[model samples]
Target chain A: MALDTKDVAKIAHLARLEVAESELAHYATDLSNILTLVEQMDAVDTTGVTPMAHPLHMSQRLRPDAVTEADQRDAFQTNAPATENGLYLVPKVIE
Target chain B: MHDQSIAELAEGLRARRFSSRELTQHFLERIERIDPTLNSYITVSTDVALAAADAADGRIAAGDAGPLTGIPLAHKDIFLTRGIRTSCASRMLDNFIAPFDATVVERLAGTGVVTLGKTNMDEFAMGSSNETSYYGPARNPWDTTRVPGGSSGGSAAAVAGGLCVAATGTDTGGSIRQPAALCGVTGIKPTYGRCSRWGMIAFASSLDQAGVLTRSAEDAALLLQAMAGFDQRDSTSAREMVPDYSAGLGDDLTGLRIGLPAEYFGEGLDAGVEASVRAALAELEKLGATIHDISLPNAPLSVPVYYVVAPAECSSNLARFDGVRYGHRCEAPKDLEDLYKRSRAEGFGDEVKRRIMVGTYALSAGYYDAYYLKAQQLRQLIAGDFRRAFEQVDVIMGPTTPATAFELGAKTDDPVAMYLNDIYTIATNLAGLPGLSVPVAPVNGLPVGLQMIGDTFAEGRLLNVAHRLQQATDWHRAAPADPA
Candidate 1:
């Protein structure tokens, strides 16, 4: 279960973080140690146990499907990095 | 006057000893003088605070005052405050001024409480210490060289330092209780959904809970009374009726069954801390309480399971901050993919990035069942241990932390060591039980916290027990002298 530098790099890439090449070795070591510690969960017998998702044993209430509010597009998107004509702008995907 | 407890301050304001404005200004001045060194506050809204204070004073003049009316309180920067910069101690939200107040903030504001400012915290509540804060680390007011335990460190430090009467804090794993334990203050994390999470910054949604940090358990009780209630807006907000926590503060613990977990008293516990917790337990025994030895067999696996579970949830919770609607975006992005990549890279801190990596890996396609599902299943086992113990005892007593506050950077390099810091506190969060940390003694001249944990929605009983302990000890009154 030892995590390697390449695995660390893959994790960083999946997490959308830019880990420096030099730092990958350190992260690999640190993360591997953490994973080792977490591997202690292997000993516990959770057979026939249904994973508890929420602490409370109640159901969530469902709401009506309705749009009751006005969109404050300008105000909401005021902090956007790139916006044009009441929409978020992104780079062209297709040629 | 500056060091008055929230109860005393409320009474003083009610009795005309001091106006709310005067109290607000006093704290404002203290923040001005001391916060520079402590770095506890990120935004001190003196103008807004004073205005709220003025309004509070008017309410008193008009004979309309409630429990926390006119009281000045700080908030962890994670909560969304209307028109104020609610940075969750990350460059990502550095300039993100929230347009709405968090349900907890809204509830506190409803009580006519004045806002002192937003406190510092670990970025997105990712770290145990406040070092991951983008602005800076919040210095422990007790010993400036040491850390104020985090990510609710600033709230704990400010209350301990007397910069504010009380403040709001959030506990995802052990954020509220752990910091309060280290800083020698009082904090409580109620049943997970007791307080609404509607506007609070999402950490681990299932694990995160909004709580209060203050100098005394009595103060925490009052704040909890205001904050706890059902809100339909937050999907997880409990439908249970909110009890008047302060009304039952004097309930006698004469026949109460207090459980002492043997696992909590075992190795890794500092001798000084063990002595303090034992003395606190002995004091409870003298108060006519019976102590029983209980076992939580799954307790040891809590830390490992929590790291995987919390990080997995955090990874998903933080996915929203990808250079989009609000928060920091990279200056130049060649493409949409580049925008998300560079924005997250530039915005998040190392600890946050590390957690995202851990979480992403745990929740990824191949590893989901082995890591994420396994952790969740283990969470139930840990919780069942508490349920069994509670069936035999009314409440559980233990040291809040295995040791008193350690020096800064002591475990910063070793994340596993840092995660172990919450061994005594994390299990309560996993079980969704109400937990309180009350200062019990001075171990090596540093405060050691005694943790009292009760079953779900039993905050009133929990506070009464902690209140009795505070009455029997002077540890909560100890404060640090001015730093050199």
Candidate 2:
């Protein structure tokens, strides 16, 4: 299960991160080492064991449908990188 | 004043010997003088601290003070502090001022605790050593050349250095306990859901838990009592009632069943660390506790399981940090994809990028079951080991780390070497059990920590055991020589 540079590049793209060409080899090697470490899990017999999602056994607690938070758009938007007319600004996706 | 415990400081405030403002100023001055070498604080809010101190004084003067009234503490930068910069020790959030307080911050503030500002941490709590921090690593207070175990390194160093009475820290995987051990302080990562996660930046939502680093177990109990409880805002917040942690400090450890896991003392454990841990167990035995040999067969796989699970969760959670909404943004993105990719690449550090990629790979279409699902199932086995051990023993005792603090840059080049530093402590996080690290003895002039693990919501029992140890030995009282 060795990870090559192509595999590293594909994963980086999936993660929405742009890795420099020079760093891809480094990442490939590092990711391979990590995979080797985790590959030990494959040896464990997990028959009939339910996958633990959350550490606590409780199910998600639901709240009543109501307006619980005050609108703070102006305060929240102050930290945005770009905004116009009460909306976040991103690059144009439309042709 | 800098060396006083939180309880002692609260007592002084009640007696009017000194106001909170005076106390805050004393610590601020110490930070100004001492932090240059330690690099423990990312932000020191002098104005905000003084203002909060003034408010605390008003409460004391009006005869309306709680146990933590007028005491000052540092936050681990991961917790949001309104109108103050919360960097999480990353360039991404370098300029991000939190719009609201984290539940831990709000609760402690309500108890009249003054803010001493945010401490440094590993970026997004990703690394074991503080070296991964965007702002340089926090140096160990005991020996400036070594690291204070992280991502709660700054909190550990601050308390150990006497710059603050206590500080807040979060442990996703031994972040609180490992650093506490290396710096020779007290730190506890309570059972998952013991503290609310709302507004505390998520690393791995399931594993991440907020806890405290302090000078003594009694101080940790006092602070944890204020921080733990249910919060509706956090979907995973436990609905259990919060107990009075300080009330159980006097409970005797007689007849206590302590489990010694043979797997923890196996290969890679430093001889010096092992000796100190054994000595600590002997002391507990003299206090009428019984030690039993136990085995957690799957314990060795904890680090691998953590790397897969934590990174997978981090990859999902960090997707929100695109260039559009907030945080570091790349300039002049030609397209939406460019905006996202470049902004993230430039904003995140190497370790963060590594994890994001690893997580994305684990959760990818073809490898999902082999990596992610198998890891989850193994997580259960690791947790099951703890469940079986707890049935026979009241608590588990071991070394907090395989070795004491290592020199900076020693293990940075190899990620696997760095990951093994937390091997003994990560299993507790995976099992969602309460774990604490109390300084036991100095090995080769560096401190070693004796770790105590308890069942879910058994924080008071763990604190009681740690409290008893601190009462009998003066290891927690040892401090570094003056920097000046």
| Each candidate's DockQ | 0.73, 0.89
Best by DockQ: 2
Q: After superposition, how far is residue B348 of candidate 1 from its true place, in Å?
A: 0.3
lDDT of each: 0.88, 0.92
Count of steric clashes across candidates, in order: 0, 0
**True-structure Cα RMSD, model 2:** 0.8
How big is the positional error of residue B293 in model 1, measured in Å on the Cα after superposition?
0.2
Kindly list the per-residue Cα lDDT of model 2 for residues B121-160, writing each as its tens digit. 8999888779989999999988999999899999999999
Using TM-score as the measure, the top candidate is 2
Docking class of 2: high
DockQ of 1: 0.73
